[model samples]
Target: MSKSLLQQLREMTVVVADTGDIEAIEKAKPQDATTNPSLITTAAQMPQYQSIVDGVLLDAHKQLGDSATDKDVANLAFKHLAIEFGKKILAVIPGRVSTEVDARLSYDTEGTIKMAHDIIGLYEGAGISRKRILIKIASTWEGIRAAEQLEKEGIHCNLTLLFGLHQAIACAEAGVTLISPFVGRILDWYKKDTGKDYKGADDPGVQSVTKIYNYFKKFGYKTVVMGASFRNTGEITELAGCDLLTISPQLLGELDSTQGDLPRKLDPEKAKSLEIEKLTIDKATFDKMHEADRMAHDKLKEGIEGFSKALESLEQLLAKRLAELESRESKLVSAD
Candidate 1:
């Protein structure tokens, strides 16, 4: 009997779980796990995650004494939450966790770089080595530049919201550790505009990732390519041989249940056989490509906005909690 489709793909690609749900990740057994601000916010709302949040608050109280500012408490709380998740996830997977920097700092090069270091510091404080974390950032030119500097300091980066070859080339030039080309977001733009559905090799999103993957493989760039934000099983199956794919658990479970024949779709040999010529871009060339690709440019901005809003919501939640605690503390002091 032939091996399962998922089993076959496992040989060619590294499957990563794209989520903050630790239990789901444990069940899926993906080699790596990735979390963004939105995913983190989602996880915090779950009843199972209450203990993690409580632990963070308890630690913050112990460390800050009687005068912890709301912002300080929030930052410490988020850090603790990230590390707690990282710790749990590390036990189930053998690979790193892609923890994102604050989305609001996406355009601020120095701030993004500093926050990246701070995130690493929190992880190290938890006794987790730097090797097990990939500091995730938006794939803006600024973010890419920040990642470049961070990589030299022995910190790995996962460049997210990437939709164009310009972003990919910039990331590669910056010597980023990895780039996450969003497959579904690209498809979303096309689908919404044209009212057309794409499948098989005809998928624009799949093709975009394929182009980037092939380019990286052809040039022997050390930066890993991870296809992310997938829309369906077809998109995932089409890019089966990508270096890594951060898949949602729903699609993963779908793949797990299905028993179809899955072939190696993204072989380096096949990429080499393609007619794509070697290409490199300077700042001017990169700008021109960005100008030419409307979908990439629009989606990149939209993704950043969505993430920023989610981060703002998280901040508000933290602020409300802090205020309530402060009020309760004042009442207790009066009673005493």
Candidate 2:
């Protein structure tokens, strides 16, 4: 029997499942898993996870007591809800699970730092070691600073919404644990801008990640490069030797079904041999490079807004569920 591409890819690079779908994670048996607000919102609606969702609402409602409205309880439950999904994912994946910090705090250094601590504390209180958790934050300068401080205190962070080399360099200089460069989203921007088809290594997204990976390896940065938001398996196969790749379940399924020669497209030793200029990543440099890269600027803002909206939608879902549960209990009490 020939090895699947996924199996071959795993032999060369760490494969992380990028989703909050626990059953899919369990079935895939990925080494690590990642979750974000949009994914959690989708997963919360899954019938299989209804109990988990309801449980969070109930806990938050009780904690806030009778004075809290459903909206207030829903707000409280939203944070805890992420931890619950993360815990379920952690139970299946042997390695770490990346639980995201609230996206709305992407630009607030203090808020990002504090939320990271609270998230870690939540996992710790639930008996999960911080070692097995990666607090994911946006790759804004402020968020990177937050990760830097959290790293000093021994909390690992995964800088996300990363699309440009400047953001990647800033994260590496921050001594962060990991970074998730948006591969498919970059491809999305280019295709929309140029109205051209991109496949395999020629894909701008794949090239972007490859550049970041080579840059990191060349400079001896320890921050792990995990290509994320893949649009297709071709983009994934093109980044065969990335430190890690967080793949969606749909793509994972496709890779599992396909078999072919998976060659190494990236290597640390090769990167070390290549001459790459080291760019300074100070605040001004980062801002300048970010501004020059229209794609990064637009995508970063768009990604943040999309995530913020997903979180809002999730809050509404929680509120509706809480009301239903509360009304049911009230009717029972009156009947008694």
Candidate 3:
């Protein structure tokens, strides 16, 4: 008889599906869809996406020549595979898709910028305009610098793996299209640190996003804040008035089935009156602030390494599949 929690949140925030699964995205019907290396790697193993995986590998071998080494094939496949998935997601969602560049390029400013351009080019080549894609990058100093340059070039970016105020402030200053401050991950760090469980408004993750949201609104920054990596429905609801929230399919299902009184926890009007001072974050200041905040420093590094490992696992998978395809082709030739 009443509006579902998801519907309530949508009225205040843009709902985005945080997944690489087409069916999940369809069911969630989120305005935007986001994919990372981990999601892509997981999707590659699914029986349904096997054809797409093989097709991308075959396209790699064809374009790079059969003599291309496994490493070469894997490298090419990674880029194409990300774009391939992004293209499919774009078909179902009308808003935009956040496709990440390689995590290995996180600390490399110039490399991140160059890859962002190439990714946008790939989308354009496929007839999808640049307007429909957000090039997601880490929130390291280098990554923020890269995003700054990309923004000037009209390439929107989603600064991800953000934890501390330093990261959020830098992102807002950089004029990023959006910033994905991980809500659940922050809670994980705090819980492990103090061995205290938190919930609802008391959740540390919820507090972090609220601070960033209020800070952004108070300062009148045009950069959007999209809270991500939610661990539960409470965290999502606490950030009710965020610019956006990229929710996992699990939470989406939970929210869809549950109906309750949902209230707007954050409002720009309330934020404007908060007396938060403007914090200037140059490289030195950012490094110092990052070092002081153990949570942000450790979590950012962990996130990057995790994504990098996932990417490596994906490359290995591609190489193994490539070898199998080659073997099948050789056997067929012998029979002929």
Per-residue lDDT of 181 in model 2: 98
* Clashes by residue pair, model 2: none
Residue 72's lDDT in candidate 2: 98
lDDT tens per residue, model 2, 125-155: 9999999999999999999999999999999
Instruction: For residues 115-223, write the lDDT of model 3, one tens digit per residue.
Output: 9999999899999999999999999999999999999988999999999999999988988889999999999999999999999999999999999999999999999
Model 3, residue 300: displacement in angstroms? 0.4
lDDT of each: 0.87, 0.95, 0.94
Estimate, for each residue in 55-141, the C-alpha lDDT of model 1 and write its tens digit: 777677679876777777776787667678878888889999999988888989999999989889988987989999999999887
- C-alpha-based local distance difference test score of model 2: 0.95
lDDT of 1: 0.87
Given candidate 2, what's the lDDT at residue 101? 90
What's the CA RMSD of model 3 in angstroms? 0.8
Best by lDDT: 2
Please say which candidate is ahead in lDDT: 2 or 3.
2
